[model samples]
Every structure is written in C-alpha cells, then in structure tokens.
Target: MAKIWAKAPSPCIGVCKFRDEGRCLGCQMTKPEKKRFKRLKGKAERRPFFLMLRERLEARDRWNYWSRMYRRRCLKKGADCPLDKLEGAEREARAA
Candidate 1:
C-alpha cells in the first residue's frame, strides 16, 4: 500500500509583487522557488523549502510578518501550524 501524505500549505500572503532583488515583496519567495513550490508534494518535501524561506524572510527582516500570517492561515485551515515549533517569539508578541 502506498503511504498517504499530507501536503504543506503555501506561505503566500497574496502580495505577489516581485522586488528588484528578484524576490517576492510579500512572501519573499523567489520566482523560481514559487514555481517549484507549486510542484512540490508532501510535508517531507516542503519542510526544507519552508525552512529556507524562513531564513530568507529573516534575512529580509520579514520573519514576524510571515509568522503571523502563517499562523492565521493555519488557524483558518484548522490545521496544526508547524511554525509554532519554530516561532515562539510570534506567540509572545501576540500575547503582549
């Protein structure tokens, strides 16, 4: 029997404009990464991608914004957010 897999949700925030640096102004994903993201399957495949995206967002100083949006998206989907494991600061910020 084939193993069932759960797909990781997209990190897009609906702001698709590309910056001059060739990254998305919203999600911070590069055009090529965004295209490849659509073709990726399963959490196993997407985990590393999201980790890299988080690093990119951190480099661009957009980690907090992305974390909040990601949490909201997880809530909306009634899914457990993997981000919670990596973003304790986001929870504390919200509590404040």
Candidate 2:
C-alpha cells in the first residue's frame, strides 16, 4: 500500500547536473523521470515514484546526501517525506 500524501514534494534538490550518465547526482532522477514526476497528480503516483527514486539513490550510494536534502525540501514545502515512513517500516520489518 502506498502512503498517501496531501501533497508530495519533488525529489529534485536543484542539483540538475547529469553527472552520473543520465541520472542527477542529487536525486538520481533522469530528465524524463523528473518530468514524469511533475506530471503525476495524486499521492498514489508520487509516492511510488519517490520510492523508486530512493532506490535509485541507494543503488548509487547517494541516498545519504540526497535524503538529507530531500527531507529539508519536504520540510520547507510542508510535505510528508516518503523516505521517513518507508525507512521506519523497513526497520520494523527487520526487527521483527
């Protein structure tokens, strides 16, 4: 089940350089993925996109830096971060 949000913020952290092949060094989203995110309307779509983006960041070992910046962005936008909830759930799953 995807976590619903009143408003999900973009995963981009303004570091738009495509330094890692086609992925952004900041959010690990490609240009098309970024555009796709902007086109998504509801929480169902956005949340999954965020999760996928997080996975991409993790694959690149960039989640640490990107998560911090993304959390700040969510704070500034008054939006709930998908990473927070997802990470907590992951920890609980591991514990049990």
Candidate 3:
C-alpha cells in the first residue's frame, strides 16, 4: 500500500522581490513553480518542487539562507522539516 503524506508548506519567507523575470529572490521559487506549489497536493507532488528549489538555491549560493528560513518556517507551522534531506543543512543548523 502506498503511504500518503501531507503537503509540505510553502517556502516563502515574505521577501517577495523578484531578482529576475521568473525567480523570486526570497524563496528562490520561480513564478510558475510558486503557482504550482500552491496547487500541489501531497508530499509525492512536492518532492520535485523542493528538489528544483534546492537546485536553484545552490545555483544562487543561497542554500544556507534558505535552509535557515525553512527551518524557522517548519518550527512555526509545527511541520516536520526536510532539513535532514538538505545536504549539510542539518549540520549547519546545529552549529548555529
């Protein structure tokens, strides 16, 4: 049987300025991706979104900042964070 999981919350950190035509400087989500994120239903659906976002963050050299913000978001929402899945993020969070 397939295990169903809740949809992860949006990663927006309230900093909505777009650094370019499609990318947001805050959450690092592209405009289309942001829209898709809002409509996505479950963990199965969001996995790819997070993966894409992670790549964007890494590309922009903002993984550390995004990781910290995401952890805070998880704490605020009482949701299980995917920090451990983000490479080196868990350790970085622990050290801070």
Candidate that would win on lDDT: 2
lDDT by residue for model 3 over 42-82, one digit each (tens)?
65676667777888788889988988988898879877775
lDDT of candidate model 2 versus the reference: 0.80
Ranking by TM-score: 2, 3, 1
Q: Write down the lDDT of every candidate, Cα atoms only.
A: 0.74, 0.80, 0.72
Best by TM-score: 2
Candidate 3 worst ten-residue window by lDDT: 1-10
- Candidate 2's TM-score: 0.82
State every prediction's TM-score relative to the real structure: 0.73, 0.82, 0.75
Candidate 3 backbone collisions, by pair: none
State the lDDT of candidate 1 residue by residue for 27-70, as single tens digits: 99888888898887765766668778899999989999988887
TM-score of 1: 0.73
Per-residue lDDT of model 2, residues 1-96, tens digit only:
343443667789999999898888888888999888878877667767777877888898998998899889988987777777778878999999
**In model 1, which range of ten residues has the least summed lDDT?**
1-10
